[model samples]
Target chain A: MRRARDPFFWGLFSGGGMLTALLLPALFLVTAITAPMGWFGMTGYEEWATLAGHPLTRAGLLLVAFLAFFHAAHRFRYTLYDGLQLYHLDALISIVTYGVAAVLTVLAAALLILVV
Target chain B: MKSQARIPTGRISDPGYPRASNPEYTRHHPRWYRRRMPIFWWLRKLAYTKFILRELTSQPVMYVTLFLLGKMWVLSRGPEAYETFIQWLSHPALLAFHALVLAGLLFHTVTWLNLTPKALVLRVAGRKIPGWAIVGAHYGAWLGLSGAIFWILAGR
Candidate 1:
């Protein structure tokens, strides 16, 4: 039988993204639990706004935002297409989901530039 | 659409012949799609746009990023810097962005909350955890975090 479009690539990409999302909570949990105890050899910045001045922190935040946005966009698009029986509008749905993801990437970048 | 044409019910006396072929299935226009192709296309695109916008606006990245950055800032300098940063977050422009991000965050939370059951397994004794339970947990977490922040700042 002739093979249609390959689903393997997308399956891998999306699966990896979901794994990242699942891991994020663990990081957050560790931070929350350890922070109060002062175990990580970390010190607080003098001002909360200082994060805006720090390039690494700002960039990391933006990266997280962009990834999460794109991941959610992809998942939601498929959920709608399959679960909701939206076969006819699949192309339009794809375009819009990607569009939103792109805008989110832009927003995250803008935030990083302005803040960092 | 004839199944008999595709499926050979072997009637050979010798019964030694084997047949293999890809069968053709009927293509359907699902009544609704047939009558509303143009309008469906337009509405479909519009709905697609809405979904995309919804996902983009409600990213968890925004909140989690800000929170982590705040945590990191506190770590680098001390509580003082973090406090100052929090205070600065209320700056007119920053606050405006905050408002927008908050709206997005809420939208994301609400929609994803509904996806809890399908996305994750929370079974017990061969029974699955109710979606409402998952949603309630999130709501509780959100409230708890809000309260903690409020308490910390109010006390300080």
Candidate 2:
């Protein structure tokens, strides 16, 4: 019997989904919503830079960004296949979706590495 | 269009063949017709629409991640580049875009967290933990993480 390789992508999708759900909301609340609205004291650029400079922070950011991108890719691929009824384009869709995610993941890694 | 093919029956003299079996069985099976899925099917039901919207939320999540990456890129270029990126973030249009993305992210978070218990079945000792307990544990972890981030940012 031939084994399908879907489980690998599904595993990444599930892990990414878990992390995104766990982390994104609060991250957004502080960084996007309240901080922008000045509810909490405005975070200075230097302070943010300082935080971003930490190795642990960079590693955490990389993990969050990488998983989240893969999650989006997997979800969007299914969405296109099922929602748009583009099963005929399945192979192309998979290639484009995961391909873009891989590129973005590399870009994210580079950016995180360079953050100082 | 449908095509039909007939099966040839083997002679009873053939070895290893069941002699009691009928010479041939004629079966008429209609071609399967798949129901056409409407493009806007999700819009027809509130639940489906919500589900689709939740899936759609991932787009904004991806965009925000890209934006963060861009921010990091700018930060790497030095304070001037970083200042420009921050100023760009403050633009009215960008701020409005972030507001919509924020709503989408929050929706994604709530629905994702609500569904966590269903995905993770936890058994303590010989007994299964209640669904609400699992949900509460997730929310507790969320709160703890959020509190830690806040403390790190503001407690200094």
CAPRI accuracy category, model 1: incorrect
lDDT of 1 at A77: 66
Model 2 quality (TM-score): 0.83
lDDT of 2 by residue, A1-116 (tens): 11157988887888888888777766766766555454666456777777778899789889989899999999898888878989799899999999999998988887787544
Tens-place lDDT digits, model 1, residues A1-116: 10135254244324425433333443443334333333343323433335336676566566666666566566666656644567889789878976877786686676566544
lDDT of 2 at B140: 90
What is the lDDT for B54 in model 2?
84
- The ten-residue window of minimal lDDT in model 2 chain A covers A33-42
The digit string of per-residue lDDT tens for model 2 on B1-156 reads 222222324556544244324544335556679999889998999998997898888797897787666666666677787666666767889788888888888788788889888889988898999989988888898888878877776545
Q: Highest DockQ among the candidates is held by which one?
A: 2
**Just chain B of model 2: what TM-score?**
0.77
